[model samples]
Target: MAANESADGSLRAPEDFRSSTCGDTKSLKKSHLACRGAVAIAAISLITAIILSSILFAIWGAAREEDPTFQNKQTENLQQCQKQCEDLKMMLHLATQDSRCRLCPEGWLWWRRHCYFFSVGLQENRRWKESAEFCQEHNSSLVEIKDDAEMDFLQGVMCNATKFPFLWVGLTDSQQEGRWLWLSGKDIQDHLPLVVQWDSDDRDCADLRGDGTLFAADCEEYGPWACKRES
Candidate 1:
């Protein structure tokens, strides 16, 4: 028998036996390479998972360390905001009280540092002298215009108030012709003379027209009036 033949007397070819042994060897090598590749992949995956878990744990640890400080800062800011709001509320309450104490009386208009009353809706028209008495009854006086500013304010008020022809003011030349004087006994300054349209007739009293013009009217003429007093 040849060295490659089976012991039972069956003949075996050397070429065929060699071919089968080479095929089995190649399959074993392929299986070993596949198993090595799978092991390498599993190792890489495990390493990646460990690295990610370590990063996550580090971030969580740092956040935990800062949590109390962040919470305290937030609470401090909230408390400051609440304190500021309380201060503003207190200031507003005090200001309201102060304003109420200084407010003008009912039926009176406050301007600058004085209170004023317009007689448009109060009573029937009165003569210039009667108008002065009516203002006295209210503990006020016929409005004594201090400057052009006061005159302008009064004119604006009259312009917006009513359609009455004119309102009596505290100005007159009844004591002497050609010599005008305010109710306060201050001589009408020549420099302060506004566009006074004097009457051709012998008129003494001055009235404010809705057009903001001053007209010399007779003292006996009946008209509404304005009064003024300190606030």
Candidate 2:
């Protein structure tokens, strides 16, 4: 009749059995609570670790950016890039100003990497030495014809400038009696002797006629002259 009694009618203590069952339930509850507590602690530790790692990373990044050496290096790189850009712009401007591949300046003729300027009036004309000095003042020298193409160009430009028989140029045999040399101290060896149409008599200076012919003449002759320099 007791709640703890079995079918065989053996004597049983209901309070002691109830107490034992309650003890087992308490053990189960404690195990469940311990498991939940351990899981919560693990979750909290992981979150703390993540937050600490993020803080450390942020600190390191900020410190690195604020470092004097790093900042100086970045500034130096930026300045170097700006300097290179400025150099490029200057080079472009100079190239536009020079370089016979492009147009020549006002009142100057461009031909094969050289710029030619002809004196306009009789007052502007000078003797061979004076003309050489004039060209040197402009940072150039009296014109030197290296080949037939150059000769033709010189003659064409001179023809447009004047109809004179002999236009003074850079060639002269003053240094040696027979050997002609340019004002730049270069020998006139490239042009053949037959190509040089000097007068039968010997003279110190040379000139380019309107017909693209070269003739030996007096060095003191006053006339218009051409100046030449690289692009």
Q: What TM-score, over all chains together, does every model reach? A: 0.57, 0.50
Instruction: Give stretches of model 1 more than 4 Å off.
Output: 1-100, 200-202
Worst 10 residues of 2 by lDDT: 16-25
Q: After superposition, how far is residue 209 of candidate 2 from its true place, in Å?
A: 0.6
Highest TM-score: which candidate? 1
Q: What C-alpha lDDT do the candidate models reach, one value each?
A: 0.65, 0.60
Candidate 2 clash pair list: none
The candidate that wins on lDDT is: 1
Each prediction's number of clashing residue pairs = 0, 0
Tens digits of lDDT, candidate 2, 38-71: 5555455555555655655555557665786865
lDDT string for model 1 (1-231, tens) is 002223464422244322322234345446545555555554555555556556555555566566867555555555654555555555445544442343344566879977787766645567789889866765668877778788788878876765556778888888887677888887767436654577544688888877767788887767778888765
